[model samples]
Target: MNAMVQSTVPASRTRLPRKERELQILDIAHARFAEHGFGAVTMDEVAAAAGVTKPLLYAYFGNKERLYSACMERAGDAMLAAVGAAVAAATGPSEALRDGLKAFFAFVDGDRDAWRVLFDETLPAGGELARAVAEYRDRLLALVAQTQLELIPEHSRERAATEVEALSNALLGASEALARWWLRTGALPAAEAADLLVATVEPGLQARAALRDRTASPSTPDRDQGAP
Candidate 1:
């Protein structure tokens, strides 16, 4: 082909298909929503960054809140998948819990903005995004409860369930708090965060075991008389 003929071609006219354009908008919107809270980021800004107009952005997402919610839903789903897979691969409950915790901290460490949007209370209130976060949080609590039951002695299952719920809430709060702190200071590594959780949880588990033993032991009563 001649150089003049090649120059005459109109830049290949590359255009993204509809699905691709929608995905591109969502990608840009995800970054924006993560960096700026759901209420703070504007559709116009997302559209501008995505090289589309506001109407096109709306066509894909309907509104700002909907867009933010979709981004949050995606993040929540990803986090759940990672944690669930890690837990499933473990051989024991302790290892499963550790793996799940590691997955969560890993995500937080890698994507601080997503962590904040998913966790931070100041972002907004009463939305699909908040509901998604709550749903994931509940699922994690359930996993912790099941893991605790598995680790506990059969006779102590009832008490273990309650204690595990409390412990799970505490661990969740602590991990989230540490994550926020790390966002500002970058002091602790993700592995260190996992270690901290295990260090805190293991001793508690041992103590609970001792208590169960004390409670379940045969009482020194006048059983020789065979009184029912």
Candidate 2:
């Protein structure tokens, strides 16, 4: 009777494929870190949440820091890919900025936790992890700078590079702030939030483009008086 009862019961755990298991662990870890921040969460908590042994978690991710890094890398890479693809598909500078912002907000809206993981302020003040995060930010900044530079004519790009980079930094900062606010308040839909940002910034961007265009174009020469 005892043997029969034991046979009837299911095992506590089932083996998963390696990639599947890794992804599962990452998803759980990502959520935990996002909710509690890296400093407060523990491997045991994540292991329990993931229904895995602590040894297995360590075997897979090596340590808590590594697990955190993995989460950051995944979130950051996904965000960059989404925004890059959106920008690549755009027909013009304005479209690129608008599409990129939409893609960014869409990503945050789809997974607010992932956005938190990517931009967690609780990360160590200075370390390899912080450096890694900075590298991701730099990559994003470069992408935005390139997008901003697109608004300037090719001939003016060299001279406008500094201003474009500054504008890119400001745009990224504003977007991050707005996203956090959106997450906190839920005041606007993702598309509308993106549109609001676009509306606020596009006029200035267009004005800069126009200014550069005028500056770069040679002034029209007056026709010779009384000459055919």
Candidate 3:
């Protein structure tokens, strides 16, 4: 009787748990958004692709904007976590930057769809969504700025904060641009891409540190003049 009752249970009754089903829907929606920009994808298409009814999808996510927001949040958090871990394990600021860049590129290479979702230019320009994206960017900016600050001498860090922030912004912007280019043209592998970025930026950073050192050093009196 128990076996018969189990056999008679409908497939819907045996559906995935709510959390699992939500993940499944998110995965499908992420891919769809990656392939087609935010403006192009429809919730119906996502529901069909995810093998869930539209009402069930709505029940899980509330609406398409929320769904896209969820995808972006997941991708952004994953990326930050990857870079943070890599940076934390590094021995020094230089290694931190290098490892962080490598981690960023690796994450993008491992999941290009997530990359697209996070970086899609077509995303709404102003709203809660925009603020959410900005918050992620700000977090990344803070991470990069912290690393850059370490490159400066401890005594000079206070005055150099603004400059370091600017440089961090530049590096972050360049990295994003390079990532987009890499996605469009797979010429360099992820590690090679990271190396290239480091090669291009490291020299300038080193030079800036040397300049700061020179500026911070006190001038010495010419004692040799009296001896001569």
Candidate 4:
């Protein structure tokens, strides 16, 4: 009788535990969101893709907003955790930045599709989606800005904070664009891409710092005096 009952049960019908099922749904939803953007991807599609019922999806995620938030949260958590670990392991601010960059490039190189899913323009047409995207980017820039603050010399730290923050933001934008270009070219390795970024930006920041000091020096004539 036990053998007969076991034979009658289909393996596909077995219920997956809650955590496992949630992961499966997220995996499918991520792919759908990547392909169709959040606005176009319906809960029904994800449920069907994951072989789960609509009610089950709702039971786990409440609604599309929460579901999307959960997905973005996971990606953001993983990214920050990796970058944080790399930065924490470094002995100095420069090494911290280098480690963070290496981790970032390595992540994208290893999982381009995952990176695109997080950064792509397929977000649902809602304020929630906008907030989600902004949260990821803002946190990332915050990390870099913090690193910049750490790198400043003690005497200049107070006055340089604002400029460093602005510079960090610019660096983040430029690096994002450069990484996309590197992806297109696909010739340089991830480490090389990071090395190139550090080499280029470090000197640029130094030059800007030197210029600021020169312009602010006491010997410099006031521009209003026409001392050229």
Candidate 5:
């Protein structure tokens, strides 16, 4: 049986909880920072956008630098989650690689300004923010190298190892550059840009696969004498 209870309740409005408010502040702050660049955004601007007082903004984020850092962290996490989810769902290396690139481009499409802050070296200078972005990039490169290694052919282990690292870095740089170009020219759909990237990458990946196969050792058949 389903029971319904009724109570005399007031309809007073409630403010967003502190935790939610902080997230709201961060979202607005991230957009502002991305739109105006780090230096051009201010606490008051963020506060106004957030519909909060400057003091409230300060209470949550402390300062512009900290706010910038928070935005970077959020953007990086979002980007990684998208790529990681795509990679996890893929059944094969080529598909995984393609999906990862698509996820990355989708992220850039959704959060262009945030991606700019995280990828562009020209943003807020020096200190922890720069260090965080550098660390994130390094980690992303490592993941790319790992993914490439998985796609490497067994016969060409040595060459594949050397080439995958280079290819990974090249793809990373090219994706970032292409995203920036897309932002500037608005010439291609994000999917088209990702497809173009995949086209550039596939030949090298095919070479790696071919090398592995060519170098792989053949399995031996059982002798007629016994199955030992």
Candidate 6:
């Protein structure tokens, strides 16, 4: 059967889905926020960069704070999903950590601007935008804590849940500092950054995981138990 072939539309003129267009605008906004601080960036700037009218931009996000919040929310969602997918796809705990770190570094390297938006203090200290970024950070810490709970044996997890959560937060904080340094230095490859985290954490993680397994194992009964 013969079918009619549709002519290709120009990408520039193509009408993207609402969410897709929103993402396109956010990408430009991320770059703008990175170059100029969030406070300095304006809807006009984002609109011009995104090649959309100011009215269209406003229609999508309402106002500057909302627009910035949307960008941060999107960035966080993408980053968390990337690392979570990496961890879920791994065959084992250690491999999960490695893959997750690799995915994180990849995300950071791929979108340094987005990273800046998420972590940049130059944004308003108290506002909806700041709150959005903070919530993302809290979720990142929660992701670490939840992952630990999922992979550990129940017996060990019960005893160590609080300690593990605290450690997870500390580790995340250190990782964030190192990431900032990595960005500033600009010398380390993404793989090396990931390797640093895996090397630093894997041995301790494995040791604890081994302990969990041992603790959860059933003990053998004594041969003379009945004679006592």
Give me the runs in candidate 5 sitting further than 4 Å from their true place.
1-15, 154-163, 212-228
The clash count for each model shown is 0, 0, 0, 0, 5, 0
lDDT of 5 by residue, 30-119 (tens): 877777788788888888888888888888888888988898898888888888888889888788888888888898898787687787
Question: Model 4: residues >4 Å from true position, as ranges?
Answer: 1-12, 124-126, 209-228
Model 6 lDDT per residue over 1-228, tens place: 123333353356568899899989988887788878777988888898888899999999999889878778877898999888998898876677778778888999998887887887787778787778778888888767766665677767888888788878877887788889899998799889889977988778768777878756667345568623
Could you tell me how far off, in angstroms, the CA of residue 178 lies in candidate 6 after the best superposition? 1.4
TM-score of model 4 relative to the true fold?
A: 0.81
Q: C-alpha displacement of 64 in model 5, angstroms?
A: 1.0
User: Candidates 3 and 4: which is better by TM-score?
Assistant: 3
| Poorest 10 consecutive residues by lDDT, candidate 1 | 219-228
TM-score for each prediction? 0.81, 0.87, 0.87, 0.81, 0.78, 0.77
Worst 10-residue lDDT window for candidate 2 reads 219-228
Q: Comparing candidate 2 with candidate 5, which one achieves the higher lDDT?
A: 2
Over 16-101, each residue of candidate 1 has an lDDT whose tens digit, in order, gives 99988877877888887777667778888998898887897888788877887777777777777877788889898788878878
Residue 156's lDDT within candidate 4 is: 65
Error of 6 at 28 (Å): 2.7
lDDT (CA) per prediction: 0.76, 0.91, 0.90, 0.81, 0.80, 0.81
Query: Which digits, one per residue and each the tens of the lDDT, describe model 3 over residues 1-228?
Result: 999999998777447989999998998999899999899999999988888889999999999889999999999999999999999999998999899999999999998998999988999899877888899999999989888887888878898988998899999999999999998899999899999999999889988987887777665345567633
* lDDT tens readout by residue for model 4, 34-136: 6677778899989988988999899999999888788777777788788888888999877988898888888888767667667766665558777888888
Cα distance off (Å), candidate 3, residue 200: 1.0
